[model samples]
Target: MYLSYEETKDIAYYMCDRTQRLTLPMLVNLLLDVSEKQSDSLERGEAYIRDRGLNWIILHYAFDIGRMPRLNERVYIETFATEYNKLFTYRTFIVRDSNRTELIKVETTFALLDSKKRKMARIPEDIVAPYKAEYSKRIRRNKKPDEVNSEEYNEKQYAVRYFDIDGNNHVNNSHYINWILDSLDSTFLLDHDITRGVITFNKEVSENQLVFSQSSIREEEGLNSDHIIKTEDTVHCSATFTWDKVKRRNMNGYDQ
Candidate 1:
């Protein structure tokens, strides 16, 4: 079994929303940061993979959030490589409050992309050996993100900023989540908190691309938001968010 790597972070002002809770996009970025730190510690970071003509690319993410970390609150985040198959690797992240209560649990899938060919590449044993992730032939099937229907949606267009591109020369994964959230109106965002989310990336968006973000809400057992991000030619990403009305107590907390 792979040993989990952990980190403690104090939620900074920039990472928090008006209500003093950590913003979802920054929360996702924090997960990525911890994962990168782990890889770098093991000498299996981005440079190592790129040297082998491959880059790690995220395919999907599923998040179960109990509550958002409040501003100035220190939380512990733990992550480990759960397992890997021929094509994809599965990882898990757990975020806990100072008292050790789990605030969020996340499962993510990642695959190797051949840098030159821009195609999915098979996982090599040598590459994953460092993580001690169990090798399995059986592929884990995660639920596909729900398709966005043809119904009217709130749409916004954004020009990919220079900072959005990572060293990999592609738009960073967390920005897609940001776009999805930004498509929603401020009122909706302020009143509701995302309790769960599923996001899947279909293609990569590059620098200077103008991407359209579209979102529509569905009222079922609870409030659900479906989102799509696409350029003129391709649908780059799609996601679904399940929300709960923000509690007054949370909204009244200290604003840092």
Candidate 2:
């Protein structure tokens, strides 16, 4: 059986940027809410046992945006679990227009965390059995993002306001998206839209902690770069973003 969920999004805030299209952080928020409906997630059956006090943490995620939906555009997202292993479970999502035209695709890996112990937990079989585990994956699994050197990066700092923290007492993954993308100057962000990205979350940053967002340019592959988010000494997260003027594809793989 394929456990599925659906939602529609309308861009009503500055969240989309001057490009007038949905931003990556908004897309991430959409998927995160959608993820709760899965049988394997903390919000759903069997997995929802509260006394056990378990939650899910994203280890890594990647998405490909073939087209960015415009402001006031209502886009539909359909998501389902692809499969799961001992420690990691994979899910895929597709974004479509009202007429069913495909607009975007995303895949992510999640790990179960025992809240009390603060450690990774193995996924139970009952959780994996319900998904459409056909050994299919839309995108290849991504490794942890590289840690950038402190001296060789452009950086910005942000305060962890109350709203930025989630129930986990840390900056919500959705807000981290904004901090990373926002570090890029407007001229570059306006000229190029995100075609794909990979983010790996390492440590956790709690409320009142100062966040340092760091980035570096890689001009070789269309427009690509790496980013890191940390405090004064310890790292919290890292990611890589690849942008293009527009989607470029070949029969074998992505052209850019």
Candidate 3:
């Protein structure tokens, strides 16, 4: 079964850049919100799973942008439970304009966490049943982010701010997008728009911790970066990012 929601990207929030369209982080945040809402409606949401002493966290995410909507433009986002394994829940999304043209499509993998035990856990059948999940794969399976262990890679450090933490006391995925994008040069950020991104979460980071976000221009592959959230020996979390040439819209932009 599929569930959906609709909203217009707020202009107020985009005063800087992407003022006419949803920024990468904003788009990601919206996707996560829609996913959570669908799970809640299916009785497999955060609170529901938390009650059972288990929770779900995104393990991998990949999305392709076709056309980004501009300010005040209405969008319809629909989400579906594609599949699940003993350890991961698979889901997908379709984002379109009011006229019904697809703007973006995304596939994500989420893993069950034993919140109390603080380790990995198998998903319970009850929750899986509610999503009507299957075993089929939709998009390409997410790969471990490519490594950029070269001396040429540029590194930037960030301080974990109070607002960056989510209810789970860990950094929100949207903020990770922010940090990853920030590693780029201002000229690159303004000139080339991101067409695709694949990120994987490795661990968790808490408040006040320092993180190192490293980037290397895969001039051949846009920008690639790895994020490390830590200050000590323990690596809280890391992510990989890949950017591509942006694709703009046409007269029949919503047709896709």
Index of the highest-lDDT prediction: 1
Residue-wise lDDT of candidate 3 within 16-122, one digit each (tens)? 25425677778878888887887777767788888888877887887777766676777888788777777887788888888889989888888888887878897
- Candidate 3 weakest ten by summed lDDT: 247-256
Candidate 3 Cα outliers beyond 4 Å, as residue runs: 1-19, 136-141, 221-256
**Ranking of all predicted structures according to lDDT, beginning with the best and ending with the worst:** 1, 2, 3
In candidate 2, list every pair of residues with a backbone clash.
none
Check candidate 1 and list the clashing pairs.
none
User: What is the Å distance of residue 197 in model 1 from its true position?
Assistant: 0.7
1-256 in candidate 1: lDDT tens per residue?
Answer: 6768999999999998888899988998899999999999899998999999999999999999999999899999999999999999999999999999999999999999999999999998888888888888888877676666677789999999999998888888878988999999988998888999899999999887899999999887799999999999899999999999865634454332
Task: After the best TM-score superposition of candidate 1, give how far the Cα of residue 32 lies from its true spot, in angstroms.
Answer: 0.9
The lDDT, on a scale of 0 to 1, for candidate 3 is: 0.70
Better model by lDDT, 2 or 3? 2
Residue 198 displacement (Å), model 1: 0.2
Off by over 4 Å in 2: 38-49, 132-141, 144-152, 246-256
| TM of each candidate vs. truth | 0.95, 0.83, 0.83
- Taken over the whole model, the C-alpha lDDT of each candidate is 0.90, 0.75, 0.70
Off by over 4 Å in 1: 249-256
